[model samples]
Target: MENNLKMKDMILTYIIIGIIALLGNWAGYHVSPIKALPGMLIIVLITIVGWGIKKILPINLPAVIYISLIALLITTKIFPGSEWIIKETGNVNFLALATPILAYAGLSFGKDLHEFKKLGWRIVVISFVVYTGTFVISTIMAELSFRFTGKF
Candidate 1:
C-alpha cells in the first residue's frame, strides 16, 4: 500500500503540471521560458519542503501554510538572492498562473452536477458575498497603503 501510494505518477503529475503552468505563464508574459525558471524552481522546491513539513508535524497543518511561510521568508531579508528572483518574476501576472487552475476547477465541478445542484442558490449568494467582501477589503487596504506611501 505504501509503495503504491508513493508511485511515480504522483511526482510526475506534479512535475508535468508545474512545467505546463510555467509555460503558460511565460506565454502570457511573452518572455523566454528561461526567465520563468526561477519562479518555477521556487514553487517546486517550496512545494516539496511544504509537503515534507506537512507529513512530519503532528498537527494537521496543510501544505499551503508551509509554502506561504517559505514565500514570506524569501520576500524578507532571510533568503539571499530573493529580491532579484522576486523582481524577475514580478511581471508574471498571477491571473495567468491561475487560468489553468481555474479551468481544472471548472472541469472538476462539472463531474458532479448532482452534488453541485444540492448546494442550490446558496452557493451563488455566498460566492457573491465573498467576492464583494474581498473587493471592498482589498480596495480599502490599497487605499491605506497608498496613503501611507504618499502616493494616494
Candidate 2:
C-alpha cells in the first residue's frame, strides 16, 4: 500500500509538471508577437501551476518552483536581454524551478547534510564524472547536429 501510494504520488507530480510545460509552450506560441510577453507568460503560468499543484496535491514537492519563479522574475525584469541570461538562463531556470521538488527530495531522503558527508568523496567523484561526460557528449552532438543541418 505504501509503495502504491508513492507510485501514485510520483505519477501525479509528473502530470503536473507536464501540464506546466504544456502551458508554457502554449503561452510561448500565443504571445510570440509581443517581445518578452511569451517568456513572461511562460514564467507566470509555471509559477501559477507550481503554486496550484502544491495547494491541491498531497505530495511534497521540491523548492525548485520558488527558485524558478525568482529566477524568471530576475531574468524578465532585470536581465531581460543580457547575453549571459540568454545563453544560460534556461539551465539556471531548471535549477530554480526544480527547487521545490529538490526540497521535497531532500526531505524524503533524510534532510540531513551530515548524512551526505559519509558519501562525500564518492558523490563528488561521480557528480564530476557525470557532469564532464554530459558536457562533452552534448557539445559534440550539438556541433555535429549543427554541421549536418547548417542550423545553430
Candidate 3:
C-alpha cells in the first residue's frame, strides 16, 4: 500500500483522463452525438463485467484482460446490432483510450523507485523489447488483414 492513492483521487484521475480521451476521439473521428454515449456505456459495462467475474470467480485476473474477453464476446455476429456498434465504437481510436492507462501505469511504476532501481536495467530492456514486439506484431497483423480485404 506504499503507493496507495485515495479512492476519490483515483476516480477523479480516471474521469479527467476519460474526458480528455473523449475529446481527442471526437476531434479525430467524426461521429454522431450519441456515438460517445455507446463508447462510455461499453467501457463501463466491460469494466463491470471484468470486476464481477473477478469477484465471483475468486480469480487473480486483471480487469483489462477480462475486458478484452468481454469485448470479444460482444463483437461477435451473434450479438444483435453488433455491426452498428462496431462501426461506431471502431471510430474511437483506442490509442486515445490507451493514453491515460499508460500514464497511470507509468506513475504506478514510478511509485516504487527503490524496487525499480533494484530491478536495474533488466526491466527496462524487457519492457522495451515487449513493447516493440507488440507494436511490430500488431502492425503486421493489421496490414495483413487490410491487404487481404483490399482495404489497404
Candidate 4:
C-alpha cells in the first residue's frame, strides 16, 4: 500500500509538471519573440518568487513553478534577437553557470561525504538510466517526427 501510494504520488507529480511545462512552453513561444527582455524578466521574477514561496509553502509547488520559469528562460534564449537581449541582461549566464556549483558546494558542506558514498552506486545507476532513457526517447521521437512530416 505504501509503495502504491508512492507510485501514485510520483505519477501525479509528473502529470502536474508536464501540464505546467506545456503551458509555459506555449506562453513563452508566443510571447518571447515579441517581448524578449520583458519575458525573461518575468521568468526570472517568477523563479525568485517561487523560490521564496518554497520556503513557506507545502508540497511541490516550488518545483513546478521553478520548472516553468526555467522553461520560459530557455524559450526566451531561443527567441530571435535573444543574443542582444541576453547581453543586455548583464551576466545572466554567469549566474546560471554558478548556480549548480553553489548548490554542489552547499550540499558538500552540509552533508557528510561518508553518507553520500553509501548511495553513490545507486546515484550512478539512476543517472545512467535517466540519461540513456532520455537520449533514446528523444532520438525515437525525432525520427518519428521527421519520418511523418518529411522534415528534420
Q: Judged by TM-score, which candidate is best?
A: 1
lDDT of each: 0.73, 0.55, 0.71, 0.53
Please give, for residues 3-96, the per-residue lDDT of candidate 1 as tens digits.
Answer: 2344355567667777777778777767566777777666667667776676678777666898789777887766898787687556455666
Give the TM-score of each candidate: 0.69, 0.33, 0.58, 0.37
Tens digits of per-residue lDDT for model 2, 1-152: 32233445655665565445444434543322234334434554455555555556677665366547655655574665644455432322344335556656877875566677777687879989999999999999999999999886
Residue 108 of model 2 has an lDDT of: 82
User: Candidate 3: which pairs clash?
Assistant: none
Which scores better on lDDT, 1 or 3?
A: 1
Better of 1 and 4 by TM-score: 1
lDDT of 3 at 152: 62
- Identify the leading candidate in terms of lDDT: 1
| Cα shift from native, residue 85, model 2 (Å) | 19
Q: lDDT at 117 for candidate 3? A: 79
Worst 10 residues of 2 by lDDT: 29-38
TM-score: model 4 vs. ground truth: 0.37
